[model samples]
Target: MAGNSDPLTPRAKIAVTAGKAVAAASRAAGRGSGSVIGGRVALKLDPDLLARLAQNLDVILVSATNGKTTTTRLIAEALGAAGPVVSNALGANMPAGITSALAGGSDAKYAVIEVDEKYLAGVARDTAPKCIALLNLSRDQLDRAAETRMLAENWREGLAGSKAVVIANADDPLVVWAASSSPNVIWVAAGQMWKDDAWSCPSCGGVMQRPGDDWFCGECGFRRPTPSWALSGDHVLDPHGSAWPIHLQLPGRANKANAASSAAVVAVFGVPPQVALERMYQVQAVAGRYDVVQFMQRDLRLLLAKNPAGWLETFSLIDPPPTPVILSVNARGADGTDTSWLWDVDYTRLTGHPIFVVGDRKLDLAVRLEVANQHFQVCENVDQAVQLAPPGRIEVIANYTAFQDLRRRVGN
Candidate 1:
């Protein structure tokens, strides 16, 4: 018998024991048990276990400061149109979360994951995905990631020497520059998906000039090529604007970019444009990203505001029926400990008096609103805010953690 006190074999023994426990839990909980138990077990397991699972998967990893979750889901759904696809559908992006997702799938031709930028290198090293999609980078969670440049450096080092086919957003200067070193790179960008703020060239510190559906540095010759797949003209069509004829279920010009990026990956797998477009029109918005629901006998719309860029895009999409607004902020670690980032967002477009401010950081949010000279009422809780607002329709803008809490409180 093996010695119980063997120091060298402790890790192996621990892993074996954990594996047995997971198997037992699976038997007790049935087929869907893995969804509940796998995450916990995977988080506790040795790094080697996660590596083994990653090595076994035919993975496609997606990373970005924004649009990763929606784009990853869309890719998985499009791939699923052809065959069964596995993914961390619950928006879990860490190593253990992804490993648990793979472990839960009984049969899968593809495993698509929304990977966090900081974890991309380690996951890439272990998983060795068949493809990687790098979407646009923007400022987000400065307390955690510090800066976008740091994450870019980490991604470059992580993807070095990998045989994975890289699909990069050429519109983002950082992404374009990062892919320059990679031999296998496919650039995708929407030419007319114009943003006045995103006009800077990462190279040469010069302004990028968009001269007729193409971007080129005025100072440097670094020019963005025409995208393989592009979205042009008005994305929305019709007099009433009740229904957008195009594919996106999510609102705003940014959603169009996300849809285009998803289409690019699907196209790489030999899916025809028509089929991809049809499938895209069928896709629905994920939870907490422009999700709509019925609550309190009225239509309720929920949009998440995590960063300045995201909030700006959401504000642009807010059509005026003059619906009552419920804005919330939170100081949870996941939502960022500092609420200073709120100052960077453009809340001026939100023209309405007596907006309801909820969540643990309601006072901070109210203070920010005051600084912006916007009208708001600080509520003790989400329920009180919802109850106090008019019942015709409620439009909510909330941070990540507060969004969940408010959703639960509103029962939508």
Candidate 2:
């Protein structure tokens, strides 16, 4: 993939320089990575900064309710086999963070961006991506983010005439409907475990009929498109019918699904499935999601699950049975101020585990666990929770902010 070899314009060069300085200052101040703040500053100085920065790079924008961060990382790893890849590897998916990331690697051959579900349209328009990966659509941060179907509709309109090759999950009707408008789409049967958000058709608002692996709207006849790529157990089946076994350091069927999609996206640039999968296998963690941290005489495997759909998939990632599972929740703005989404998640699956609840909204989680008839202990914090548990490697499943808090506490 050839890119413009010319240097950035004088204004663009100045903006990038200023943004990098701000990021460095923020890092020095210990106020968190200045990716977002730095990008915001750069954008304010030049509104077209993203476009100018992205002009020379073949951008791949990844948007989804979940898995976007990990998927973006995987795509970057796979693309790295070809040449240098610039990415927002910190899970900063907004425009500012994306801009800040792009500004750093002007000579990088590719840009793998994780776009916030709400901001995909704007970012896509600005980046003019060579490929767009629509992973899945589910209910997440409903108080601050657009509803699942509404966001899908936005994606549909935003990507209507885009020349980017859209790599989409065919199992998710919401994703299929959204990607349908794209002129070029590579559908992958990346399994969707959570089907709650897509019970109705986004096209006709009719009840969806999911018959085994296939789904169709009886009223309007909107159906699942045949996938060019699919996952059969732990193996990825490319359009050529060759199966590549997916062996990852990252756990769960969800990750395998993510790998399948990532392979497809990188294939656009002629990276073979086997080559891509080999590169992706080295990624053991993404921004500390599945990081194994030594905390409080216990090895804590940090698991992040934001909403019901994400929680469902995360449950599979945890070690099964009498192994203690620490449940944490938070109502911070980043974690969605409304705790009502807690009710939507089925906490009953943790029945066999010694469950402990912690975080700012632990009481809400306690109530939900009670209603689900799953016994749990209410702890003041993760430290107390871990101390209470007869632990070795404790599975700590937390929402966005809670996960970050625990990750920071553990110095991971």
Candidate 3:
């Protein structure tokens, strides 16, 4: 409606009016597209209509490869502590999905949506949020996204004309470069207290030095100011040194980064650092993203490892020892049609042989594991594999679809 005008506008309007009349005439017809979770028919409506739907609402857009959902949920929770908040909790990251989530909440004071990088350019144009949280970009869904640089370029273009404040991860080289070009930017850095990886400079091809958690191009002197809000100081380690006590409900180093990013965004909204951190410590995990479940009388950690980068981050979090494990892979189109990226993962570092492999594409995973000279128990289904798993400790690593099936089977 805001763009090119069609000569059939009158006809289209008449048809829409008639359709609404007929739907009203039918008792089975309810409140329309905004009702269901994935129902996003509003996206097809005129741009003016969609624009009106989001007009004057405070919008927060969160985008990243790995931790977007967790960080988005955390920000939503922290903002909710101040006032009413709305978000797409079902992992809908596209334009239509965002429209559906916003359409459902008319009384919301703030709206936070986890937008996928691929969809950011298009969605940002329509929604035009007040704040955008640019989480670290990592290689993910290479089949669809091609490369992290491509996604970063799209984000830079999408945010070029935005009036919102941009919150970025300062430690990420790509983000640091992008934020340097933006006007209103807030850097969120994980202080020296935590060990994490930083990217090198592409211009000079030099190893970037991190003065604290803020990184700078060692050769180019390209570095932004340090973050005002940082996650630093004392850490409480788990008994086995596998996990550190974050004082937050969520676990892992990635979650800590998420917590730090969320705190920074909320701090921009006038929430004190201490208050935001206190509220974050009470936040819960978004379902399926490192969600802990009780299965077979043991703590079952279900992590969604959809790409090589995510898998690497997960591996860093768990840091498997010489203990046996269970890893599952699916090559279904929905879960990701191509499994060729399996070669990119350093599966050799995994402690011992994968005890069980289960999924529709269990054989494919088995072949990879076998090629690595690792023993595996291939099963037709997850339940059968779970039954055969050793009694001590079991870790289930699954992709999208397999993760869904595993949750249903485990009664989670």
What's each prediction's TM-score? 0.83, 0.98, 0.80
Can you write out model 3's per-residue Cα lDDT over 1-412, one digit (the tens) per residue?
Answer: 2322332244334433443444344425443333232333333444443355456567888987777878888888778767788898777677655765665565787888888878876767767777888877766555666466556666776677578888887667766665565678877664322223335663455777766545678788877566654545333222123223245777667777777777768766776555666777766657665666777677667777877767776777663554446677776665668787777676765746356787777787778777877767888776676677766556778887787778787777
CA deviation > 4 Å runs, candidate 3: 1-39, 191-225, 233-246, 295-299, 319-324, 371-373
What's the CA error at residue 17 for candidate 3, in Å?
13
Tens digits of per-residue lDDT for model 1, 155-184? 776777778888888776667766666778
Off by over 4 Å in 1: 1-37, 43-46, 191-221, 234-245
Candidate 3's TM-score: 0.80
After the best TM-score superposition of candidate 2, give how far the Cα of residue 140 lies from its true spot, in angstroms.
Answer: 0.7
- Best candidate, TM-score: 2
Residue 335 in candidate 1 has what lDDT? 79
Q: What's the lDDT for residue 77 in model 2? A: 96
TM-score of 1: 0.83
Candidate 1 overall Cα lDDT vs. reference? 0.70
> What lDDT does each candidate get?
0.70, 0.92, 0.66
Tell me which residue pairs clash in candidate 3. none
Order by lDDT, highest first: 2, 1, 3
Winner of 1 and 2 under TM-score: 2
